[model samples]
Target: MLPLQIGSFTPKAPVVLAPMAGVTNRAFRAMCRSYGDELVYVNEMVMSHAVVYRNDKTLTMMQFGDDESPRSLQIYGSDPDMLGRAVHQVCDEGRVDHVDLNFGCPAAKVTRKGGGAAVPAKPKLLQQIVRRAVQAAEPYGVPVTAKFRMGLWDDLRTDITTGRICADEGIGWIALHARTVEQHYSGEARWEAIGALKEAVTDIPVLGNGDIWEASDAVAMMAQTDCDGVVIGRGCLGRPWLFGDLITVLNGGEAPAPRRLGEVAEAMRRHARLLTDHYAGFGGEEHAMRDFRKHCAWYLSGYPVGPDVRRTLAQVSSLAQLDDVLGAFDPDAEIVEGGERIKRGHTNGPIKVALPEGYLDDPDELAIPDDADVMALSGG
Candidate 1:
């Protein structure tokens, strides 16, 4: 396997944790890293304006654990100047070693404003944002990277051009999600596009994203696409240990055996405890446990646990409640048939991309959509 090099930093493993909005916070990153700390685990995506304006919550979200190394952060926005300021602030302050620009978000709330996945449609504007971001980080010697979808939709493809622009702008590396904005998270990701992008962007490493649901999927993606590395997204939702599995398989070993229900429960407890500690300064354990309610479903997705237990766990607001609910389950039970392949997040798609009127009129013209700002939305 080829090692991944982002600037002067080379990860012990050629894997990266894709920055998911509400999912990839400090606790989750640490949880994933506990399984394997050598890979790049990016903090959740923050709006560039939030960083520039010093939004308290956003700034706090950027915090890293003491042991976190090669700290990576992802930011998104439409205005080059604002992104530049945000990148400059983080880089100058030594807050992050790697800064990733987000251009692949497909949410209607993002694209309607000509941000996220919509930004790639306007080649000139995309270039400006990437260029300014790279320029902002260059002086600090912090690497700048970008991730984007294949295009707005099937009819309008911009990944090749986007890759070229990012490479020319001095981006340290680029990741292709391999799904169009319209496709959202539905359907199969086009791995062939990753192969194409890797061929087109020879100067920098190209990482592949989308549909990496298991450790074997990661190995298969690298073998098929010849990408420099694999970015794990929805695959690691309930399975942080997937990182460990990836390390094993990528290093020429077989994946570990399936875990029992008790083991999964143990992981859940650890995750909950980590979240509680992360939010200790803000809302303490109660708030943290409440925030963890969503993860209950992800963790129990493939388990044969009864509906009553699932419902109870989903609403658990304290560590005591979590333990009580999990304790009722049989520890020896294993995952249901085909449970590992079950998708966890943003599974619906193929909807019309919400773009500003005439947003696609001129790909060469540099422009910003009306009513778009960094604070309007968060994450990709």
Candidate 2:
């Protein structure tokens, strides 16, 4: 396989961890990075306004480990100016290596405000935002990339045009999820879109995302679309080690054998511990453990545990309680199959996506309404 170059940084492997809100925090990213080298891990999408205004949580989300390679950040905004400013801040800080714009989000709140998937419908605004972000990062030598869906709705196809514009603006890469905003996450991702995108742009790499549940799926995506790389999203939800599997397959080796329950439990403990350490200054282990409750199901989805066990695990408020509940599990149990591919987050029905009035009227210029400045409530 060919190496992926973004600015001066070249990743030996083309695999990347797609940024997902509430899931791709420092602890989770660190866990996944341990399984693969040269795999770029993106921070959760941060609202541009939040970044510019120094929202405490948003700033914290951008924090990366000192040894993290190719620190990547993803920003979401509908306005070109705010997005540009956020990119400039990232560049000026000299902390991040790559920046990815978010146009693939399908949350109702985000679409209602002319953001996320809605932004891509206005080709002009999309181009301006990409251009401004790239220009902002040019001086710092940070490569800028963008991720988008196939289009606003199933009936309104726009990803091909939007992708070409991104390439024209000198984006380092373009990631296509192969689903429209209307389709949301319900149906299958159209691999055909990725194949078409590769044909549309020749200079930059096109990373295909969506529906890659296993290491073999990555290989299949590459073969079917001829894409440069694959971005694993819902596929790696409960299994961060999927990255390890991806590396193995990409190098012509078979994927490592499935992880046993005991091994997975150990990983879960480590993830919880890391979360404690990350938020220790603010809330201590108890608070951090409380926050980790949300991931209990995702981490232990396919296990043979009963409802009583799961309830206890979910209600854990402290590290000690967490340990007790985890200890009750038979760690030696066989790892169950098919649990790795279960959707873990953001499974919602498709609703009418929101956009600024007349957003689609002129597809060639930025048309950010003042109301669009605020980040949508649901998308983040």
Candidate 3:
């Protein structure tokens, strides 16, 4: 397998933990990193305004443990100036090793504001934002990367153009989730698009994302697309050990043994504890556990756990109650197969996509909006 590099750090394997909002926090990243070797874990997307203004919640999200080396931070914003300033802050602070620009989010709130996928449609804007962010990050010896979708929609295919622009702008790496904003994680991801993108950009590594539900799938993605690596998003939700599985498969080793209910509960508890500790200085354990309740369904997805038990766990008001509910699970129950790959979060059908007037008329328009023209959201 090919090794992955950003700046001075090189991971033996080319597997990355995709940054998921409300997930991929320090707690989750720590859990995943513990099971694998040489995997890059990214922080969830932080809005540029929030970061610059020091929004408590956003700043809290940026927290990384002392041992968390090669820290990867993903920042989202449509305004080039704000994004550039944000990159400078992250690099100037001297806390991060890599910075990833987010252009793949399909949230309507982001798209309605002419950000995220919408920015790519206007190649000039995309170029400006990337250029500014790269310039800001370069001085600190921090590598700048970008993650993007194939295009804003089926009618407007811009992945090739956007990928080329990012390459020309000196991006260290590019990750393509082979689905358009319109596709929105609906149909199967087009691996062919990844192959085409790899062919489009030669200097930097091209990572293929989406539909990598298992370790074998990662192997297949590489073999089929000849992409350099894979970025896993939903596949590792309930199964953080997936990193271990990916490492094993990449090395021609067997997948980790199946985990039982007791083991899964233990992992859930561990995740909660880490989150508590990570946020303890700010939110305390009660708030942290409250935030962690959302992950309960994901953790116990395919298990034979009853609805009542699941409901109770979901409604858990405190960590002690959560512990009690988790401890109530049958430790000896066999793990049900296929739960590992089920989709979680943002699975709803496509809504009407928003775009600027006559956006498709000119793909080359890269107008950088002034503060007055800035929209509230940039990506969806």
Candidate 4:
């Protein structure tokens, strides 16, 4: 198979982990990275404002383990200057080899402030942000990419126009989530849109995101859209091994056997262990495991989880506690039939996008709205 090149850097595989907040931390990224040398694991979303302000939590979130070969960090912000500075700092500090800007987030909090998916609604503002970031990263030889949605809504889709802009601005590549901010993760992704994005831009590679729950789905997406690669988010929530499966399938090899409960259990344990290690500074293993509670549902999804067992696992405060719980459960059971493709992240959208007032009055508004400044912190 061929390598997926981003500027001078190359990923072992064309698979990339979408930068989901809270979930794609060092522990999680390390696990996903272990799946393959080529699979690109992007860090959780980092706010450019926070990075500019040197916010401790946001800085901590930017930490990457030594194992993340071809490290990529996704940064979100509305201010062109702030984003450019953030990208420059990351490059100057040698924090990562690649930087992906987030223009696809559809959360109300993000759009309310004129950030995230909202920036793409204003082509001029989007152009400036992308342009400044590219200029900043170019000096360091760090490839910069942008991931965006179809548009604010179907009536005002910007996927094609945004694709053209990124191509002209020297962006390394473009990723289209194939849904509008209003669509969230609810409706089926429009693969045809990915094809349209690919067709519209001839200079840079185009990647497809959304609805790739299984390795087969990635294969199907590539075949259907002819995209350069796939960006996976909620698909790997409790299934980091999906990266391995993708590698196997994309490389002309059969995917590994179905993960039994025991296999999943082992993965969960490793994840917990990594969490403990990652948080050793702020708090030790006990405190770190507290955060692991949220992952219980995803890890045990479709398992025969009893309420009592679920409660215990959710509240597990230490690695030993997790082990004891695993000890009592049978590990050979497989994930429930057809559970592999469970809808995990990004809800469907019919919600109105909270753009700044008059955002839609003119699509040609060239000035960056004051409301569109970078969020102090970033998330979905």
Candidate 5:
């Protein structure tokens, strides 16, 4: 596979970890990076206004490990000036190596104000946002990128248009989620849209997201769409080692065997510890353990760990409790057949796309939404 070059940085593999709020923090990133080298792991999405205002929680969320190379961050906002200022603030402080604008978030709180997926409906506004971000980061030699859905919905597609605008505004690259805002995280992603975007935007690299549950699925996306790389999101939810499989298969090697129950347990223990360390200044180990509770069911999804054990483990309040619960499992046991393909993360979608009143009335208008307070939302 060819390397994914954005500006002066080039990852060894054309693989990027999609930013997921509360999921792609430093600890989780370290876990995924441990399995593969030279991969781009983006921090969770942060609000531009929060960064500009220096919100403590937002700043804490932006922290990167000292060893993390080529730190990448994803920022979302509806106002061009706010987003631009946020980009400038981070770049000026040398806090990030790459900046990605988020335009695919379908959350009602975000889109109700002509932000997120709704922005693409107004091509002019989308252009301004991408251009502002690119211009802001250009002085610092940081490449600005973007990730967006197919469009507001099936009838209001804008992937190709979004790609062209990004390229014209000097974006490093663009990733298409291949699903409409209406589709949310449900249904199959249309790989054909990725190919169309790749074909339309030839100047910069294009990457594909959505439905990449395995290494082979990533391979299929690149082959079918000729996209430069693949962005792994929900696919790597609990299986950080999926990065290793992706690297191996992309490099023409066979996928590695799944880890046994014991190995999985060990990884979980390490994740819990890392999270505790991460939350030390914020909420301490207790708070960290609570955050990690959601991951318990994910880690044991396909394993025959029984409902009682799963329930108990999900409520673990401390590392010792985590260990005690995990130790009861059969270390040698393997995930059930086809367990690797089980779905994780948000599986519901195809909701009504919320937008400002008469938001779609003028696709060329350059107006921002009223009282949206998009900066309050965290992730898309």
Candidate 6:
């Protein structure tokens, strides 16, 4: 029982799928959940502003497979009223089992507007956002959780403080991505910060994120920090089956054996099918085929393939092309041991944090500009 409980919801495996910007859609989540019976899959973070207005694209992005029980969605916004309205809107639609606030995002488009990780820098503003969201979801029994990074920058980290604040605001659970905006996804994650947060906050579950590239790493993190649960972000990319392995480990078994190329290739095909089926009207196979090109690098990573195969897969624009790409591989080949250690996703960081003037000078400033909401078509 790691991050085992949250109110009445007790995830059997307690392995959470962290929400990515453009990833983790309905199609992707269903595939991941299908791999593990108890996996908790979070939809990609959606800007509350978009949800409040009932943006078709945002609403579509929030879709979950019928079987995706305990469906989780991450909401990003800075306004209390708008955020509250957004929370209720999602719950009223009866589509969400959980709502996780996005205070951890370090994207420049988000931070520059005093949202995301920048919101935590202003405790009062963060409190407003969380309080309103929790209140809005209370009537619907939608458990509200929160996921965030360490802080805006290294010199100004605020993980422990934010943990206390979120716990105080009644967030059912909290996840900390043990790195700061400055570090982004570049430097090695500092698990020590996760331990510090676990020590500082005792009222609610403290789930640790970042640096968990393998199942054994999750075990080591739990042993090292005593955190309640492990929230996986990049580790599951192109390998939704990672959740299956996580389930085995949480159940006192070992992670699964190295995957055969055939198994991986088949999963890729299934993922493409799921995407096409779910996005039926949104370009159908044509859209799915193009969208899935991005996942090719992740799915077939480290496998032996020539430039021609790679190039062909790089711009896969149709199902026939996708089939050809998969056909070029030796499906029976095995993943070299520990190949998962290779890093992927948002690796650039330690860069200057974009922020409003004096955003860090006052923690009491609760007035986020009407413009601070992520309000983007993609990602926070």
Best by lDDT: 5
RMSD of each: 1.6, 1.9, 2.2, 2.0, 1.4, 1.7
Clashes (backbone N, CA, C under 3 Å), per candidate, total: 0, 3, 8, 6, 0, 7
What are the runs in model 6 whose C-alpha is more than 4 Å off?
Answer: 1-3, 371-380
lDDT of 3 by residue, 134-244 (tens): 999998989888999998777778888888999899898899999888888787889999999999888888999988978989999999999999999888888888899
Per residue, candidate 4 scores C-alpha lDDT tens digits across 184-272 of 77679999999998888877889999889888899999999889999998889888888989988987888887688988888889999
- The TM-score that candidate 4 achieves is 0.95
Score every model by TM-score: 0.96, 0.94, 0.94, 0.95, 0.97, 0.96
Q: Which ranges in model 4 have alpha carbons more than 4 Å from their true place?
A: 1-3, 367-380
Query: Better model by TM-score, 4 or 5?
Result: 5
**Which model, 1 or 5, shows the larger lDDT?**
5
Question: lDDT tens string, model 2, 1-380?
Answer: 33577666676568989988877878888889877767889988888889889888777778888888789999987789988999999889887899999887776666666767887777777788888899999999899988988887767988888888998998988899888887777778899999998898778889999899889999999999999998988777778899988988987999877777788788888888988877866676887878788788777877788999888887888777777777777878765677666776666656667765676777665547343444433342
On residues 148-191, what C-alpha lDDT tens digit does candidate 1 reach at each position? 88998889999999999998999888999998888888899999
Query: What lDDT score is found at residue 187 in candidate 5?
Result: 89
Give the C-alpha lDDT of model 1. Answer: 0.86
User: Which 10-residue window of candidate 2 scores lowest in summed lDDT?
Assistant: 371-380
Task: Name the candidate that leads on TM-score.
Answer: 5
**Pairs clashing within candidate 5:** none
What value of lDDT does candidate 4 attain over all alpha carbons?
Answer: 0.82
- Compared with the true structure, all predictions reach lDDT values of 0.86, 0.81, 0.83, 0.82, 0.87, 0.82
> Model 1 off-target regions past 4 Å?
370-378
CA deviation > 4 Å runs, candidate 2: 370-380
Q: Residue 116, candidate 6: how far off, in angstroms?
A: 1.2
